[model samples]
Target: MSDTGTPRMKRPSLHEEIVAEVRRMIVDGELAPGEWIAEMQLCGDLGISRTPLREALKVLASEELVLLEQNRGTRVAPITFDAMLAQFEFMEALQMFAGRLAAERASEDELERLNAMHREMIRLHETGDRSAYFSLNQEVHTLIASAARNPPLFSVHEASAGKIRRARYQANLSYDRWAESLQEHGEFVAALTARDGQRAGELLSDHLRRTGIAVCSALKAFEDAGERAPDDRKGRAR
Candidate 1:
């Protein structure tokens, strides 16, 4: 702890806690997409007051994780084909930019760190642990972005990440798609290791485009099957 001799903060604010919990619930399917969030029910489950919960919901809404209807309550945002495609277009461009920068600028130490992360991801993928694999995959990509040392690019990438995380999660639901993702990631790491910026950028862009197609196909199937439930809980919270 001698780097600065300062104590690290370990506690999160009430709003932060609530926000994280709610986001997890949404992303993990504890709260389904398009599901209406009953205010009293959720507050009771979390044992929190309305003030902090409302603040948290407001934050999530801004991130597009939740929809706040005027004179109505909050609901988890529904996933749609068009919305997923739109987000992926932006994400793909940013990822390509980051990949090029990372290949050009990542230090040996940084490459070692990313290689370690890539190994873990490979292990998870081989074991068919989709959830854990996806989580690590996100970290690997984030590390690449960080290694790029482009603050503005990282800022935009981080913001887009929150909105598209759920879509990315859903993209790998198909076994074939998941396997393809693992293969793509392997090549991506290889490109990074070789310091091939152009190759890395191309791989990253292709990876994102495939993910977008997967998500759109899945959403279309859901729509065709009429499996999506209508949100009926739409009134103002008491």
Candidate 2:
């Protein structure tokens, strides 16, 4: 089974690769909000067959990063600062609940892991490495959620958090803001270690709510700089 007189090669799953690449494209703002994506073009762009490309599209749709239509193909879900605000309200409650549950249930090892992530986050923030800090941001939330020892809660939290990648990155514009956020995260882990449910919940809520405000501020600043995004009136409702 040779092609071109050489051994046939196996490749990593194209669907996963394509989906990851497309997701990165979306997150980096290369694929702007409300912009339609063409199956043929994406296949061509990635030099993959249509089958895997379609599979990747389905995966992206499930993640709510892209919306699919039977006839017109797919487009990115529109983003709105208003949605960011609403998400903040919902996420504040979700994370606070998660924190409370974690305080009630977290094992010693899990609590240590949570504290370890916070320390690493603090270190990353100190390096002023925005990209590294972003990755650590994800690790922090995930660690807390897993520590809660509730699969349903963890799944819901992950789904909600997954949908807001852009908003979080946009929030990191002000250097002081990120420092304050790291400080808050450290306080959260401390509260968790003490098994202080109420205090942990408060810190978690304040963290997400502040992140929402930060993203909104970033949006406003971008608009002020002549970067015009749709007014969200015509965009996705949430």
Candidate 3:
């Protein structure tokens, strides 16, 4: 309660802000996966001391976004194909359930809000604002999950979604995939509008499956190129 007797919004503490910033850095690939975290450099960049930075890192470690190795120091967790596949599979199941529930439970106002968000996402996409589009893209998924009216399902979805956000973002880097994703969302919205739970669920799941394939393909290509680079260098020397 505030002094005026109205409930006051509690602001996030510095510790919480640090955690979120670090998490964003990792998710946005500013802190690359498998790259060792330079604690001192980060502390200097963020203008914070080691104590709070370490505390923030511990929280990220718990989220499995960072690895804490004894003596080896902390590094951003690597995004492996196996892990990406598993995460997408898990998310596909969750989204399918949520899509069904959302079609059944979402109110008119909520559905309208989702439509509005979809419009904004389209605008962002057309303008080539990828970062903003990606953020709104996640928001669209979040809104659908929220509309499901199932707390336990939403909670689990959110926790898992955080882990795979980077993969989802990276999957959109392909122009074809990005455009296809928009078309999928359009169909998804139409299904929701018609209150067709089955169609909505299937569409959402298929969308995720495609996204998983794109991410896995991209990761494989990247790893293959990295491996070939050394051989190419040796050949040039010979």
Candidate 4:
């Protein structure tokens, strides 16, 4: 996190604000992966006590953003590139099934909901809002999961979303890519409308796997630019 903390008015509980800022720091690469976040120093810098800081740390720890060893204190958990690749694989299978289920069960209302989200996502593309676009990208996936009406599928998708959001935001920076993703969603919608389960499944799985490749490419570019991730880059998502 920045030495000066969030750098805004801090009238809230202080803990929440600090946690949000620190989380953003990790998400935006300000706090490098695997770096230890010293509670004492952070408390001193933010002019807060240990109570709030520890609470904030526990929250992050639960989210797997950081690891708390028995007595070694907290360090940012390494983002395993392989684990991320594995997530993409799981996402492929999960979303394919979701697509098939959606094809079978989607009502007019459900299709309209997905379509409305796609329209808003398109608007985000025009405005060049990468973050917003990724958020909607997440919503669309989760909506499909929910529409599948399978609690287990919904749980698994929700669990993976935090990691997926990071990868998506890191990769889909260009406006052209956002437009392309919108078009992909359009294809998904078309399949759903046509009641084509197998085709929809293929499209959904391909969409996720391709997006994983995009993010992996971006990660490789970062490493080539003379930076290091706390994660391994040992394989191709292709």
Candidate 5:
């Protein structure tokens, strides 16, 4: 221990690091959906052993990010427009509920935090930092959910958020759509600031619905361009 330290913080385990890396790869499309997850390749790239990599795969499997099979080993989970819409349906409901509850119950401090997160997101958007803006956009939603002060609701919201995260990431790839989304977010914040629970809920529902539409549009654009995701491969077990 250092002289002034009470205790040294433990570092993330190798398995945890592997899991985080794999998750990022999947979300960033480095490991595209329905692609074979080559354990050996990943182990080499990440400079880790098969043991930890397998362990990390187990964690991702539990999160529905990857699929494990007895004969097929593992593959990135298949993504479909229908599936994306389904996940967004649940996310919309959950987030709308969260916005309503937050508007009604949020403490002054929580409201301030939400405002600060929105400001940061706007700043990143203006600078054309899409990745950073998206990151903070997620945080703003999470903080809004937590501000509801309902533990059970927050738990459910977090699970749904995880499932739809990748599709949501793809949704903002178009510049015009991204700008429109920022405007929607601004309206949401304004509703919350006014403590208008009904308006906030309505705004949140519309925002998430629009996001799903944008994601679908992006998927169609990719299809039209003949850019196929790994999931399109036929005769392969998903």
Candidate 6:
């Protein structure tokens, strides 16, 4: 193929790979919130030098996934209850808007794709594959956002979505909550499939609100049981 006709594919750079790995570690709870990040240990584990690792850390820091301290060292950004609630509140608005637009503008193919993903998500949930289910769950939401046909809105929603990914995963930690969330998704999909913009928006907003309350309650329970340190609940990390 001619140079103009052939697409140039660039593999992910080492720094980008490291950034994604570390971000996944944080989101998957492999690195807990408020826990110190041991630079040397992480370097040894990833088989990488400090330069690329630090570069990756800088990117993650910008994403608010990790905190870089001057002397105290880096730590995973803490997810305080208040911060979680605030994020959910912000996301509620975004998702509601997206849902309404998606319902009105989504193509038939987009709706079919969503239905396929939802079916697989249900299967994953049935098999108790929480991890896979969560991944598909995020994709389902993303598809809806994209279907809205609003670039600016989708961009903002995606950025904010990354920030609260861990919390969204945590929402399904409880079996009851997981089931309830699944049912909510069923209703949401139905509304979107029927092109009921108002109903879809309301359902999505309500889902986010409920998710926020559940996560806050779970955090409070953890605090009460001393699972999380008292200081962790004081304030959110910047």
C-alpha TM-score for every candidate: 0.84, 0.77, 0.86, 0.71, 0.80, 0.84
Model 6 residue runs over 4 Å out of place are: 1-11, 168-172, 229-238
Q: What does the lDDT read for residue 231 in candidate 1? A: 26
Residue by residue across 3-115, what tens digits does model 6's lDDT show? 79987777898878999899888876678788999889999999999988999988989988899999788999887778787888998999899999999999999999988
User: Model 2 Cα displacement at 155 (Å)?
Assistant: 1.4
Native-to-model Cα distance after best TM-score fit, residue 158 in candidate 1, in Å = 2.7
lDDT of each: 0.78, 0.76, 0.81, 0.72, 0.78, 0.81
lDDT of 4: 0.72
Q: Give the per-residue lDDT of model 5 (tens digit) for 1-238.
A: 8689778889998777788889888865678777898999889999988988999999899988899988989998866777777888887888788889999999998888878888887788777776677667778888889988899999888766765666654443457777788889889888998999989998998988887777766666666776753322111100
- The pairs that clash in candidate 2 are none
Clashing pairs in 5: none
lDDT of 3 by residue, 1-238 (tens): 9889999999999999999999989876678778899999999999999999999999999989999999889999887778888998988888899999999999999899889988987897788776677777778888899999999999888778777776554443466777888889989988988899999999998888887777777666766676311111111100
lDDT of 4 at 203: 93
Q: What does candidate 1's lDDT look like per residue over 1-238, in tens digits?
A: 5479988777898778899999888765568788889989899999998888999999999888899988878898988878877988988888889999999999999899888987887787677666677677778878888989999998788767766776554433566777787788889889998999999999998988887777777667767887663322211000
State in Å the error of residue 90, model 1. 1.1
Comparing candidate 1 with candidate 3, which one achieves the higher TM-score? 3
Residue-by-residue lDDT tens digits, candidate 2, 18-71 = 888988777656676678987787778889888887788798889888899888
